[model samples]
Structures are given as structure tokens and as C-alpha cells.
Target chain A: MAKKLALIASKGTLDWAYPPFILASTAAALDYEVCIFFTFYGLTLLKKDISDLKVSPLGNPAMPMPVPMPNFVQMLPGMESMATMMMKQQIADKGVASIEDLRRACLESGVKLIACQMTVDLFDFKRSDFIEGIEIGGAATFFEFAGNSDVSLFI
Target chain B: MDFDKEVDAKNLNCPLPILRCKKGLNDLQANQVLKIMATDPGSVKDFEAFCKQTGHTLLQLDQTDKVFTFYIKKRNDAL
Candidate 1:
């Protein structure tokens, strides 16, 4: 039997979104069965409109910049959008896979994408909001797979 | 020095190189080699781990300039 991997993806920022799908796709490529549980804000990754995911640099002193700026400067009204644009530019220049690309790879490779049902209800999201081919499930369903996983991570 | 196919993973970041390599290997016959050229520095170690885990053989690892080249031979009876 193939090794199983379970991942909980709980963040939605552009920067935070890459890890789970990246790991899951790679694991699937490596012949491991992989599943990612998208809960809380992470569910945004599965939304039909993923083009608007943004990264915030506010209070993130470690975020690399052409010139390091103070938190006050990062807190400026337009700074978040600026940071998101910069990050998008960097990603394109570096040939990094966009989150959507990685997520598609995961799905194509048969990685199970599970949206947290409770969170879906809590957030007042419609099932129609997500892309095709995702399951809606809660913690018990997650534990069913996570229990036997050879590798489990909360990303 | 010879490979049945080549995957141009050049400039692609993590998982892409490996993902492309996997797709390339999938199209090859057993023991046929797949060569991958990548510009991402991380692909060096990533390919190593990929080959190790997938039962593919890493025949050669070479570098010239910024490119990292990998030659992988697909496993017999590979899934």
C-alpha cells in the first residue's frame, strides 16, 4: 500500500497558501496518497475566485524588501496591495507555481481536497462557491484519514 | 550521457521540477532514462529525494552555469 499523508491547511494568505498544495502534489508525485483538509481561511484557496488572494506584510518585519521599511510604513493603506503586487512579481520572475497551479496538480494527481463542513457553515459559504471536485467533511472525517497517515501535518 | 526523453523544468520552483520529472518518467519505458534540466537551486536536493522515494535511479547529476541537470532511469514495474 502506498504511504498516506494528511495535511491540515488553515491559512489563506497568498504566502501561506503554497505549502499545503505544494507538499501534497509532490507527495502524490512520489507515489504517496495525500489529502489536504482546508479549514478556516484556508478554504479560500478552494474558492472559484482565487485570483484575489493577497499577502499582508503588516507587522512582518522579516518580509524582504528593496529597502526594509518600518511597521508603520507597512501599515499604510496601500502597503498591503503593494506587497501583494511585489510578491506576485517575484513569483512570476522566479517561475514559482501559482497556488492555483499547485492546487490543480494536487487534484489531478488524486490528492483529496476536503473542505471543512463546519467552517463552510460558519462562514456562510455556499457549496457552489468552490471549484469542482472537492468533498465537504468535518473533523471526524479528517481523523479517519489522519489516523492512519504515515505523515500528518498541520500547515 | 544518453536519455530517452528530456523534461525542461528550467526556472520552475519547488514541486514543479519534480512534478514534471514524474510526468516525464511516466511516459518512458522501464530502464529508459529521463533527463531533467532545472534552474531552481532547490531542485538539486528535491530531485535526489524524488528519485530515492520513487525507485528511480539517479544516473548522473551535473551542473554547468546555473543549470542543474539530472538523469533518472525509470524503475521496472513502476506504478
Candidate 2:
């Protein structure tokens, strides 16, 4: 009776990335057979250069910070990197753990990591760009696996 | 009777109790039972869903006013 869990991860931002990882990790911990499908922007999570993935500060006026800062200041060249670093540090400080940690936990707990084949082809990325132990597949593959699952989520 | 492992998850919500229960289960040997004590009303449904999805056996559920307890046996320890 072990049901499969399919998580559709489609965003690259720190906020967005955490949800899929956290949920999948938690599900796996519960001994639920879980798989995460990384597509489009979400594919950035597996890149060797994780520092490059960023959350856009544009349009959203409510991005929280310890101190009040102008939108223009946040848009500066190095600000995105700074923000990512700060977010990483904050997560660690709060004992919330990192996405890397969650990924490791998920893998250790038998959670499957899948990269979307269509998205990879769309983005023109090679398999070498992904981390080790990740399986590559398409929508049909995921649907076939996920169709019988009791719980399926899009994060 | 086998002694069941207990986890107190007071005031935790959504995924926290379930997360802790999972971690606790992982620490045990196969077929060992874990009893989770939770105040979250959602835990009943959540743990039920968890057992259905994970293939674990949910042996019992006890509710007394504000507290809820679940007895779950770890089934995937071999993995």
C-alpha cells in the first residue's frame, strides 16, 4: 500500500525551491514513496552553480528584510547574490536547514529526484548539468508513475 | 507487549508532527510501533493519509479531549 508522491517543482527562487524540497523530504521521512519532478526554472536547483538561481525582486513590493531598503537598491548588480546568501544564512540560523540538506535527506530517505525531459530539452541543457543520482524523464513518464498515487502536489 | 516509542508534538501544525513522526520511525527497527501524541486536530487525518501513502500499519487511535495518540508500526526499515 505504499503510494507514490509526485511533486512538480517549477520555480527557481529560494522561496519556491524550499517548498518542493521540504515537502518531498517530509513525505519521504513519513516513509511515503516520493518523487520530485523538476521542470523549467526549477531545473536550476540541480545546477552546479546554485548561487546563480535567484528570486526576482521586481514587481513584488513586500519582500521582507531586516532593514527598510529601496527597490532600486535591491535591484543593484550584486544585490541578488547578497540576498541569496542572506537567505541561506537565515535558514541555517533558524535551524530550518538548507535545500541541499533537504535534498540529501530526501535521497537518504529514498525519495526519487527526477528531471523533466521536456523541460531539459526546452532549456537546451545536457544531462551533465544535473547532479548525480537524478533520473531524467518526460510528462508521460511522470504521469504513468503518478497516476495511481494517493497524493500528488505541484509546488 | 512491545514498548511503543512515543513522540510529543504539542502545538505543532501541518507537517511538523508528521515530520517528527517520520524521523522517529526511521530511528527504530523494522516492525516496531511508534505512538505519536499530538494536539493538532489535523494529525488524525494527516496520520491516516500518511499510513495509506507509506504502507505503514496504523494499529490504533485514541482521543481524549485535547490530546490524540496514534500507534504506527514501521514497515520500511529494510529500505
Candidate 3:
């Protein structure tokens, strides 16, 4: 009896891009139908370059302080790598599955994974760059699908 | 029991654990139970809201120290 949920994913990194999938998965777990639309940096999720996804530290003033240094300074050296490791480990430690694992589960669970057509064009990405089974559509189409959803999240 | 599937999501942050649990339950029958073990504090609120908004039954909720457990029985046929 669960209502549907639309999760909009916009981030690039595994750390920043997990919310949409997480929310959609949970909604589906609750027996609600789920849909996820990946736009902008969120498209990186379906790419093979998943490991290269990282938060841009330069303009991000709120990046968590590593030690006593300012966030700007923390962006130096291997900070991105450190952050990625920490985030990945945290997700794993929490007993949550990996992005790839979750992605597979989602496919099997009937979660609709959509790639934003505008974003694909904006980034000049070839269709081959994305995963094989995703549906490519515009915002209007996505919204149409999401119209009756009881819950919607922009992650 | 063979009737239930468990998803351990303890110590996880918002969304992923919940997402994993969701995927785990999606394939279950209407009366099947999906047990979720989570440690994120947000889960308490997130799952509550999820059930309310989705119309699923949040059959039981248990929390201890860093562990949070949820028992959700699918009821799509009743929808």
C-alpha cells in the first residue's frame, strides 16, 4: 500500500551522490514504488568512472575540517582520497551495501533509474557512457512519472 | 525464518541503509517481513515518515545503544 517516491540525484561523488539511491531504496523497502532521476553530476553514478567522483574542495567552505586546519587547507594533498575512503568505509561499516551492490539490487527490485536527457546532452556524453538499462528522458517526463508520488526527494 | 529477509544497516548514514532495506523488501510477498538493523539516528524519523507516507505497516521498531531494528510487513495487495 506504500505510495511512490521520486528521488532526484544531482551529486557526483559516492559520498555526495548516495542520498537519492538510499532514499529510493528505503521507500521501496517500505513497499512503496520508487523512481530515481539522475541529473548533473549525479550521472557520474552510472559511469564506469565511479572511483573518480570526488567533491570539489576549492569552493566548498563547508567541507568537514580534517584535524584543526581550515577546509580550504584540508583540500590539499590526498584529502579527496581520504574523504572518499572515509565515506565508503562509513557506508560499509554501517552494514549498508556498496553503490554497485545497491544498484544491482535496485534493478532487481524494479526501481526506475532514469538519466536526465538534458544532462547527458549538456555533458556531451555518449549513450555508451551510461549503464545499459537506464531510461533516458527529460524533466517533464520525469515529473510526469513522479506526479502522483507521495514522497519526493532532491538528493 | 524462510519467510523473512534481514538487512543489516547499522552504523550507516541517512538513505543508503534505508535504500538497501527497501531493495531487500521490494521482492517480498505481501505478508513477508523485512527486518532492518540500523544505527543511524535519522532512521527513527526517516522510517516513521516513510511508512506513514507510503502506507506500509511499520510493524515494530526496536532500538538499543547503536542498534535500531525495524520490522516492516509488505501489504501492497491491500493497497
Model 2: residue B23 alpha-carbon error in angstroms: 4.6
Ranking of candidates on DockQ, top first: 1, 3, 2
Select the stronger candidate by DockQ from 1 and 3.
1
What is residue A86's positional error in candidate 3, in angstroms?
3.5
Candidate with best TM-score = 1
**Candidate 3 chain B lowest-lDDT run of ten:** B16-25
How big is the positional error of residue A130 in model 1, measured in Å on the Cα after superposition? Answer: 0.1
Off by over 4 Å in 1: none
lDDT of 3 by residue, A1-155 (tens): 45788988888776666667666665566667888999998888878546566654555666564555565666688977776677666666766667776676677667898999999999999889987778999999789878988888788
State each model's CA lDDT, in order: 0.93, 0.79, 0.75
lDDT of 1 by residue, A1-155 (tens): 89999999999999999989888999999999998999999999999989999998886767889987888888889989998999999999989999889988998899999999999999999999999999999999999999999999998
- Clashing residue pairs in all predictions, respectively, total 0, 0, 4
Which is superior by DockQ, 2 or 3? Answer: 3
CAPRI grade of model 3: acceptable
Model 2 chain A poorest 10 in a row by lDDT: A51-60
